[model samples]
Target: MTTGIGQEREKNMEYDLGAEVAEWMLSQTGAPDGARSTTTLMGLQWDVFPGVWHPNPGTRLFTSWLPIADGCRLLEVGCAAGVTCVVAARGGCTRVVGVDIYPAATDNTRRNAARHGVAGRVEALTSDLFAELDEDDVFDVICSNPPLVKAPESRRIDTATEQMVYDPGYELHRRFFREVGPHLADDGRIYMLTSETLADPAELRKLAAEAGFTGRVHASEAIGIPAPVMGSTPAVVAAADEHGVVRVDFTMLEFQRG
Candidate 1:
C-alpha cells in the first residue's frame, strides 16, 4: 500500500499545473473556499475562467481524440467547467450543447462559449440527466465525465468537483447508459470516463443492451494513486487488497447506437 505523506506528494508530482491547483483547493476551505479553478486546459487557452470544478485527467485525455466532423451535433452531459463543449466548438462541431445539473456549470459553459466566439453554435442548460432534453433532439456525439468513482456513501457531497468523483450506487452510470440512446442519433457516438478496475464490464454491456446500444473500452491508461478517493468501502478496499496495490485506470468508453 502506498501510505505516506511523501507518497501523496509523489502522486501529485504527476498532475499538471491546473489540476494541482484544483486539488489544493479541494483540500482547503474556510478562506480558500473562494479558490477558483483555472480556465486553461490541455494548452487550449480559454476566454472565461472556471467557475466551480476543474477539468480532470479523463476529460483532458478524451478531448485529445474527439473525432472531428463538420456540422456534427455534440452534447456533453455533466459538463463541469464546459471544457468539452468549448473543445467541440473549437474543433468545428456545428452545434454544441452542454447539459449539467448545476446552474454554475451551465452558466460557465454559455459564458465560455461566448468568450470563445462560438456562442451562436453552442448552448448550455441545466438538466437532470435527460429530463430537460427533447426526445426528438438527438446528437451526433455525446460525451461526459460522469460520477463513476464508487466511494463510501456520504450524505454530504463536498465540492462541485467532488461531485464528479463520488457516485454512491453508481446511479449516474445506470441512468446515463439506460437513457442516453434515445437522444443519440443513429449515427452518433457516446464517449465517457469510468474507473477501469471498478466498472463492471458485464454490467456495462447489459446496460447498453437495455438501451439498444453497444459499449466498448476504446482506451485506458493507468493514472496516479487513487488513494484520495479510495475510501474504506469494503469492495474498494477488497479490490485494492487483491491487487497488492491501489491503482486507478482512467478509461475512455465508446458507445454506439445498435
Candidate 2:
C-alpha cells in the first residue's frame, strides 16, 4: 500500500484501504519498496523523496475519515510531501494549509498542490509546530501523522535525510498537544495518527488530556514487525521485547479543543 509512508518511519509496513486490520493479526509481510521514490495513493501519483514522510497506513486511515465540509478551513500538521493536504484541497476544502519543520516538506507540498491543480486553495509553510503560524489563522479541521517511533539514541538521525522516529520520552507528541491548542478553532477537530510502538491508546489519551484536549482511537491497524525493521533499531526492539510488545498497533486519533 505504501513504500515509505512517513519520513521518520523506517518500517516497511503496508496498509490497504477498506481492509479489516484485525485480519492481518500482526502479519509482517513484504511491501512495494522501502525507498519509495515514486508512488500513488488515492488515485494520485506522488513524488516522495528521502527525509520526507510518506503517506503511510496511519495517514490513509486518517485522511479517509476526514470530516470534509464545504468551504471549510483545513490544516495538516507535519505534511511531509503534501499528499494528504493535496487530497483535501482537491476534495473541495475552501482553503488548505500545510505546515512542517522541514523546508523540503513545505516546498514539496506547494509544488505538489500546484501540480494537482489546487494551488489556489493550498499554502504551505516551514514551521516548527505552531511557531510561525499566525494567531488569527484558526482551522476548522487539523490532521497530523506525527513521528511516533521510540528510536534508540544511537540510531542515525539526519534532518537532511532522516527524521527521528524515536520520541525519547514522547516529548515531540506532548509538545504538539501543548502547542496545538491556540491554533484550533472553537469548533475544530483534529485527526492524528500514531503507532503502538511509541505509545498505547490509553497513554495517547492521557497525553491529550494533560494538554486540555480529549483524544480517542478513531481507526486502528495491527502491524507485524519484520526482521529488517527490528534490526534497524535493535535497541528499541529490545526495549519493546522487554515489555513483551511484538506487534505494533497503528492508530488514528480524533480529538478537539474545548
Candidate 3:
C-alpha cells in the first residue's frame, strides 16, 4: 500500500532526498556496469557501473562472509533483481532461495538467474521475510540488506525497491536475528547488512546474544553519499544521528552468525 505518499518518490524528495538519490542512481545505467568491472564474488560477475541497485555494495560486502563450499544451501532475504542470488549460485551453492515481498522483484530475479544460466540452482519467491518459508527448512548461509530507514509514519510498505525510511525498526532487526537461528543448520552462518541509521554493532550483537547465538561484526564502512546535496534532509540527518555517527547516506554494517 502507498503510505500516504505520492505515486512517485520524486515528488517528496525534499523529505528523504538521500533515499531519492539512491533510487535515482539505481535507475541509472552506470552503477551495474561498475559492479561488473570491479570484483568477482561467488563466481558471479556483477554489473555495478550503471547502478540499477544490483550488486548493492552492502550486499557484495556481506557476500565475503559466505562460505564457498560446494553444495551449500544459501538463502538471500530481500533479494532485489536477483543479482546476489546469481552470485551465490555461481559460487557453487547447491541451492539458492531468494525471498522478497515484491512480486516484480522476484520476477526480475528469476529472469536474471536464467540469463546467468543458473536458473536450475536459484529459486525466487515473493514472501514477507520467512512467512512463506517452511519452518523446518534449513540453510548453510543467509544474507540480507534489510530496510533500515527511520522516516515518519507516512512511509512503510513491502516493496523491495521502496525506501522503508522506517517501519522495520530496531525491534524487527532483533526479531530477524532471533528467528534466523531456527532455520539454520548446525554449521550454518548468517550474513546481514544494515546501516548505522537503524542500529549499530552493539545493538545487533545484543540481539543475537539474546537469541542464543554468537555474533560478530565482520566488516563496517562509513555511510558514504555520492550526492549529499541532492538527498540530505534534516529528518534523515537527525534520524541517522540517533543510532551512531550520522554521515551522508548510510553506514554499511555486516553481521556474522557464529
In lDDT terms, which candidate is top?
2
Report every candidate's CA lDDT: 0.67, 0.68, 0.62
Q: What is the per-residue lDDT of model 1 for residues 105-162, given as tens digits with 9 covering 90 to 100?
A: 7887887777778888888889988889988889998888776544444535766656
Could you give the candidate ranking by lDDT, starting with the highest? 2, 1, 3
- What TM-score does candidate 3 reach? 0.66
- Give the residue spans of candidate 3 off by over 4 A: 1-55, 150-165, 197-199, 222-224, 228-258
Model 1 root mean square deviation, Cα atoms: 7.9
The runs of at least 3 residues in candidate 2 whose Cα sits more than 4 Å from the true structure, single-residue gaps closed, are 1-36, 151-164, 223-248
Candidate 3 lDDT tens digits, 1-258? 665555465334434544554454434323322443333445655333223345555555556545556888988887866777887788899989999776756776787788789999999898878878898879988777765553444555544334422334465566677678777888777776655433345666677777777765566665444344334455445434434333533333334455
Candidate 2 has its poorest 10 consecutive residues by lDDT at 14-23
Clashing pairs in 2: 5-54, 5-56, 6-53, 6-54, 7-53, 151-166
Instruction: Report the CA-based lDDT of candidate 3 relative to the real structure.
Output: 0.62
Q: Look at candidate 1 and give me any clashing residue pairs.
A: none
Return whichever of 1 and 2 wins on lDDT. Answer: 2
Q: Which is the winner by TM-score between candidate 1 and candidate 3?
A: 1
